[model samples]
Target: MSDELQHLKAAMESMRGELDAMKAALSRLSRVVCIDKDDDGVETVHIECTDLLVRPWSDPRHLGVHIGSSEEGSYIKLYYHGEEHAAKPAISLAMHADGEPHIQLRGKDWKARTDICIQKDHGVVAVLGTNEARGAVMRAQPGGGSVAVLHPDGQARAVLVHSEQHQFPGSETARPSTDLIFANASHDTQMKLHTDDAGSLMMVGMAGHSDGVAVTMRKDGPAIIMRGVEDASSIHLMAAKDMARVAVNQGWLAGDKAAASLAAGGFGSSIELNECDGTKRVDISAMKDSASVQLLDAAGNDSVSLSHISGSHSSLAMRGVAEHDCIRIIANKDAALMRVTGPQDNDTDITSAVYEGKPHVLVRGRNRPLVMAGEAEHGGVVCAYGLKEVTGGVASLAGGPVSGVVSVSSQDGTPLMTLDGTDHGGRLLINNDLGLQRVVLGTKDEAGFLALNNTGSNGVIACATPEGGVVSVCDPDGNVIHTMPRLKDDDDDDD
Candidate 1:
């Protein structure tokens, strides 16, 4: 499609023969001495002043194979037809000073090459190449049928007939390049799989399209994730198959910082979701002993919580958003509790709890003593009003005088009985369901007194100085039904 693509395509195609051709070229180059002219020319009938075997081409004495003698050594040399002929040898096989056979091909600066060689260790090697260094080289060892292909850089790009039993040798031993392509004899590309320099898979597919899809790795490993632009939304899914670990993280455009993330493998799994604030989160994870689901507030406080342990252990709780572990439901292997709180402020609540081998349901309000509706172990339903907690309710009837100033009100919230503040003794008034005062018992003038009333009348019978222990029971007509008077002085204890 473009110049770069064209180059890449060409490069890929060239790679197919790069190895084989290289080895063939080197094999030819190394076999350079076997020139056609070496065995050509006519031989002399007898030894004479003029050396024998001359090629009768171009000139009479020119281009002849001769036996020469010098103070240095007796060797055979080939000469070209020139003014200074016989000064160099096109091919020479001679004896070294060490008495070992030595061989040389081609004179200095002569650009001639051949393709066969016989040598030590490698018995015979055929080198194939073109120029001085012979680009595209191949060296074949006849003894082992081993052939090496070298790149221009002299690096062995490929080698065949490895010593390992002539097996395929495995591609794993192939130093494959991300750009390397292996094609059929026709050089038609069928596949190219590669990984980037960072070792992240650049691609894995056919015909350079890599499974008909192009891939790019960013940052890390073989994990596939589909993320929206700018990471505003994403779905992450990965599994470490070896460890059986699976994880997922997904978010929506309409959700909080974290919409949902689940990571659960054999060891454990957890999912978090719907966090309004970064801190407002719900997390459910498994533990070796139990599993817990906790919903926390912005302050990292658990406002709603639930936990269950394998062996008889479970709990559920709701608390002030600012507090933690203010349980609504906390249980053990056998039982649990539940609590409901005011939607806001967390001031009023109702709870059912198991305490000290008993179960209690407590109704509580803001700045008000709790009302407990429970049953004693051997008793029936017991109801009382006082301080109550998950542990249990206070052991008192109407609660002491400090709590004595309770209010009983009508359906309209009008006080039927108003008993106000009693840190030092307050009034206790009883009223009808219509909020009309029916009886009042309290301290007036620093003396204890009790007043009785009817539906429309006030003070039907009154105990003026109840400090002396006296009571007046009233009738509906506003008359004293009976009176119990103090028989003794104000000795207080002398009843």
Candidate 2:
């Protein structure tokens, strides 16, 4: 019996050895459980399983980390293990089928609240969500970066971007720029602020349009534009090197289809009002030395104009249907003149001026006479010349402090008649074609005298002296040839 017992014991020992050897072999082959030491003396424990759950030693139903793999790929998840055992993870880091890495943070209810991922195209992307709806997304790529805030429905409400190569809406080329954009629920852009190589720009969208107002600051200057529903209707304000301008455009409206503009610059300032078809209706301009306002006809001819020049003149002109026919009133430091002109250079001019330190008025007509009234060496004088006819005459009236004169002349400028205030009283003289006096009437020593001369220098005279009236005829030598009612003394001596 002792021998039998020893045999059984030997078999038991052999079986135990075989079992231990199998265990070692399986351990080496499996890779499921391993404990290794590196050359640096660092120890590492590796465990392979369908799922790995790490929990607190003291409490198995608490927060823990879970690492697992599935058809969808490998993932590491952090979750809670309570009586209500969570079905979903609070946080997950996964390698998806797309060969990308992704991280997700979830709410208590297991709804994803945030996600960070690396994409093939975009270097990195982060999305923040609320109630399963994306609230915001940020993307960073080699070419650019952007942050977009979304509506609950996933439409982007606002976006900010910094791009190395950004292409604008209608441009084929790309540029580096930074931009901020706001959108409506429909994802239509409502407002945008952008900066590029050229400068900065801000645009506000209209109800149905993307650009209702645009303000820009460029390398050259700054500009602001506000648009209406119609593309052609707008208001523009701009400033350049040394100039500024504001223009209102109404090409959409009939009758007055063009733009009206007001501008000011180093040289001057101006305003232009336009008519339909882009014709100029009115223009007002001012310069350092001159200013003018013009009203234009439909054909852009000046219908009327008022202008002024510093140290020069102010003039107002009105044009007729024919551009050459016009009326002009001009005033200068020395004179104020009004001119009316017609086709063929026909003109009439009226002038009031200070001539030789005296105020004067002149009226003249093209191919006609000139009338001048003014303060002359005498008190006041009015002179008229007949310019229409070659043989026309001239007449003038003059007044002095104590005397006045009326003169008439022929076409050759020879005096035909003259009525003048003499030292005694008055004198009247009539001349012939040779400018020789033919008749004379005058006041002498308080009496009246009349005389008539012939071409031969013979003359007849009548005189009213204090005593009486007498008539005498004289030869060219001043000798009395005959006498009617001869002088009393002479008659007596002769008798």
> Using TM-score as the measure, which candidate wins?
2
TM-score of each candidate structure, all chains considered together: 0.35, 0.87
Compared with the true structure, all predictions reach lDDT values of: 0.54, 0.83
Q: Name the lDDT of candidate 2.
A: 0.83
- What candidate 2 gets wrong by more than 4 Å, as runs, is 1-30, 38-50, 61-63, 81-87, 123-131, 169-173, 251-258, 320-327, 331-333, 340-345, 455-458, 489-495
lDDT of 2 at 417: 97
Off by over 4 Å in 1: 1-193, 196-222, 227-233, 241-259, 274-280, 296-301, 319-327, 341-349, 355-357, 363-369, 381-495
Worst 10 residues of 2 by lDDT: 250-259
Scanning candidate 1 in windows of ten residues, the lowest lDDT window is 159-168
Question: Which one wins on lDDT?
Answer: 2
What are the per-model numbers of colliding residue pairs? 27, 0
